[model samples]
Target chain A: MNTVDFLNSREDLLSPGISACQGCMAELSLRVILKVLGEKTVLVVPPGCMAGAAVGGWNKSLGTKIPAAMPQLGNSASMLAGIKAAYDLVDPDVHCLAYAGDGGTADIGLQALSAAAERRDNIIYVCNDNEAYMNTGFQKSGTTPHGARTSTTPVGSVGRGKVNFKKDVPMMMAMQNTAYVATLTPAYMNDFVEKVQKAATIKDGLVYLHVLNPCPTGWGTKPENSIAYARAAVQSRYFLLYEYRNYEFTVSAPTKNIREPKDVTEFLQKQKRFAHLDEQDYEEVRRVVNSRWENLKKLAGL
Target chain B: MENEYRVVYGDSGLYVLDTASWRTFRPVIDETKCVNCGTCLLYCPVCAVKKVDGRIQIDLSYCKGCGICRTECPKQAIMWVKEEE
Candidate 1:
């Protein structure tokens, strides 16, 4: 069956309805992850966009048909690791999922996540990265790209948005000796599904899937452009789709074929957060993205 | 089942639970043009796109009308009709 047919054949593990912003790729990606993981999975959504949107449940009714919990913001990965340890005592087949935002993953949760990865905790930790603390009004997070106008990184005569490049969380996780590390985007559902499926099979240690999602509400883009922006992010090499396992790296097919990356502006220009970027800033962003893309190609032995 | 989503989007212009009012341009699915690819259903964040009786339909009652389905439709099987007061 094709992608569409295959998707339709699977059961939606999430509830029938969720209140995430329209065209929210993070929410859509979460649904796909759960679909691939199936019913024998326990979901942990830290205090982030996914939880705030009620993916952790609102009342007596569970948000997901399966068991779910909303853990503290910074402890989702370690918490999921603990759940996995308990599951090992029981079924061991049950997957423990940590669905957290970039803020939770790269900021407050980094310590616990690093510790979990170091201990080789068996859990799948997915970082839904919209570049900042989006649900909390777009404050700057560790993963926020340089020159993006997050709420905390206000643009003005004095302030010119975030002054640092986006922290390469996937590479960091890979370096930490994770059993698996992959980059995901909602635009390529096939790639996303494949990575999530591969992650489900990893049992030896932590699996880190870092998704660069588009938040229209936070990025000040039209909601419909969420997927478009996600596509551009990869096409422009601002985000590369790749997976790391067994100490080897391979670029996903979609990203591997891009011989000439589209101009970085194609991705940055779509978001209001990057509106203040001058020509020089664009060049700088292009330089950083290209350098990172080249580094990945080397790692993949391209 | 709609009661499962009580989070209001007053920012979309009202304090209503029925979020159909939040749509600026309602998606009009052209069943005649549709090839049943299910692209709309897969990309829809709200799961508003559904297959009922083997026919694709948009659940406008819950659709926030982001127009992503229409934009993503390879066949252009969906149209965007501006919501009228």
Candidate 2:
């Protein structure tokens, strides 16, 4: 694709009358995704940040002419399955997509999500994970990593923040062996869109993608550094990006060594959520990040 | 809660995904030009695109707001349509 071609389509995907923050990664994600999906697509959103962003009382966030529907807080997967089934009944050529957040995916709606994937539901599941539940407040969720403070995980001598590590969701989704499973970032738009396109073509099975969206208000970072912090997290190996299709792993980012790992200070210091972390705790956090990166590299056979 | 608004230079109410935005950096696919060849599908990094009933489709949740398919399509089927007016 030429630069002009890329430049031309951006105008139609994401319109301006939405409530997303200035540098909201989720907003950017919706635009890129809808542009390719086109107007003939159907979107199903659950009660998460996506729902709050996309469908408001007055202004529907999506810019595309594609029709969208909203399900309950934890029923997007089932809703997509129903929508696909109904569309099939009519024999119409349309795509059904379900978008949710980590809370909806890994916690409240886990059962429905697994059932849909196991049944080979003909839909795309996109989890716009900002690591915490930012819509109602910065409450922590399953995707929140250890040591990252949140509204649910306050900082004190008891601990820095979340007590548990982030869940290995992609691996779990890959376990379904449905068809396509990927973990991507807004930083890599080509890879991200390409994957979305591929998911659209796959046969009767579930296509699952977990996107790491950095939050300015929740993460206590500046709006300008939202993308920068996200890219750094991936490049630094703190949050690895990769794709797994039919059990084969392809690591998206390649880093030399995570030692010292670009100083977690930049990432940690920016967000008030992590303001409690001291220098001594930095070593533990670094160790965790390195270990996760090494494990992912091994999985990718890199 | 409330819809957010940004003043735009154009008369049309459309505000397309500005490719220049730092938060996003990819091309958008114009459905009018897409031919459902599925070539862009095979190479996509996230598998965001798919074919439902022989028609190419896109999944936004995993899309990362990238524009790879917009450039890769041979038919020039996918063009970037900006926001209304």
Task: State the C-alpha RMSD over the true interface residues for candidate 2, after superposing those residues.
Answer: 11.1
TM-score of chain A of each: 0.98, 0.90
Q: Pick out the ten consecutive residues of candidate 1 chain A with the lowest summed lDDT.
A: A57-66
Candidate 1 lDDT by residue in tens digits, A274-293 = 88888999999988988898
Lowest-scoring 10 consecutive residues by lDDT in candidate 1 chain B?
B7-16
The superposed Cα distance between candidate 2 and the true structure at residue A265, in angstroms, equals 3.8
The best candidate in terms of DockQ:
1
Specify the CAPRI tier of model 1: incorrect
Q: What fraction of the native interface does candidate 1 get right in terms of contacts?
A: 0.28
Model 1 ranges with Cα > 4 A deviation: B1-18, B51-55, B83-85
Compute the lDDT for candidate 2.
0.68
Question: Chain B of model 2: TM-score?
Answer: 0.55
The per-residue C-alpha lDDT of model 1 at residue A56 equals 76
